[model samples]
Target: MLLEDMLNHQTKIPTEWHTSIRKVGQKFDSAAEVRLALQYYSIAKRFEYDFYHNEQRHIRVYCRFKHTHGCPWMLFASPLRNLSIMSIKNFESTHTCGQHGENAGNLRASRKFIASQIQAVLKVRSDLRAVDIKNDMLSNFSIKINYSKAYESMVHATNTGSRVVIDADDRRFRRLFISYNAYIEGFIARCRPLLFLDGTFIKDRYRGILLSATGENPYQPPHRLIVISDADKGIRATIEEFFPDAFHSRCVLHLVENFKKNMKDFGHKTNVATTLDELLQSAAYKFTISE
Candidate 1:
């Protein structure tokens, strides 16, 4: 099944691979997209490749054992003329190296891929463990990745929260601060130039901090930032790190809750506590202050 022997045989890819990138002129948004598609195709088919050329202009990958086994598998893609999008130019459907063993798809695992796979789980559970993610990948995707990769993916998913932009490869994940494009646009357009930094301890395996910055929401008109959480030292520190200029305010709701709890602890009657709470709330916002 060597490249030299490929001419004498009628070997070609089977039709069952729904994720195949073999079609010429297949378009993609960027080089990262093309690479990601190739990774998906390889993972789906249980194959591996080495990047022969990976540049801003083009990407060319061949079978990992191309030299040793003379595998004919290869794919090449580049940007179309005067366009930013990439398109597949040439592809060899035959892979002499053949299907790899269990967890072969792990070789193609990237932070972006892992992030995508775990996004659904993250929607339901924030304390998802790296071992659980690793095991899930092995069970669901037939990919056996390192615990570090799983941890990094978990961190990236939690920080980015519904946003993911894969940069380069797994080893060189572009470090970033979190901001959605829509949020940035809203802040630049209708919102004031202020941020409300806050944090809550994640009930996670690592028991880490969940730092956040909030401004006027997308649906709202011009408004000020509001930090809504129980006042914790973590929020003060986080604001110092991410938004040093913005003032941190304790949430009034949390303060009210604490007041009620303290009243109960002091053996105050329920009716008395309720009357005091109502008084505080009505007097709390008599004058207009930025919430």
Candidate 2:
């Protein structure tokens, strides 16, 4: 009734297929060859493949149906020394049992392949929810993935999409930021030479100061914002280290706050503090440097 049934009875086997065991000694330059071989074998035998040993240089796959009791239908392959091409080293064709069923060796859930597909989806829609992702996978690929696996895939995809660099420790986190090629390119092309630096406190589980640098784009109305963490030295040191030649300016709001705090510490009365704040604001809005 099935291909495996026909093959087990010594019925005629197709010799035209490229994936026949007769093609074993053939050379391959990528892991795709091994996958193709496994797919072809699974289709012929109606059994799934479970990898026992999968690595960069070597691979060992066994029949999932008989893998627990040690089925002899195994496939082994490795790359050639001093060459990139991979060749099959050994293969066992005899199975101790009949075919399992259709959809036996589906590889849509493989870690590497799934991670890559998730990354592609995240690149376009970074806000996609994990539950939605799981639903989409089921609807599109007929692959039912658990919530944890989908969440892990989403996190992996997000990290891959946004290249976040960090310096931290168990006690405290020092610095963290996202830097991508497109952001860098847009900043260089559209933003002005002047940079405004500022920092604010984040009210989160792990409270930390969020330092940001903003620049005005000549062709665009929106400011290009880049978030870079301040090392122990301070925001000035961090900005200077990265943008040594750029013209830096302090935020007027921070300047006013510091001035007000200093005035208050000097025992200034309410009237005096209010007057000083107005004077500071007026000075900040002056049109000429001499004013």
Compose the digit string of candidate 1's lDDT tens values, residues 40-141: 777766678888757877899888889988999889999999999999999887766755555555677887678877989988987789899998887766
- RMSD to the true structure for each prediction, in A, is 8.9, 9.9
Q: Kindly list the per-residue Cα lDDT of model 2 for residues 1-291, writing each as its tens digit.
A: 466555343222223222444445556777776665555455444466778757866878877767565667877888888887878888887777565544443443654444666677777887899798888766654455666566656655655443444565763557766555455566678775445555789999888778765655465534434433323356667667886654445556666777887899999997898789889988988999999
Worst 10 residues of 2 by lDDT: 9-18
Pairs in clash, predicted candidate 2: none
**Model 1: how far residue 55 lies from native, Å:** 0.5
Q: Quantify all predictions' global Cα lDDT against the true fold.
A: 0.71, 0.62
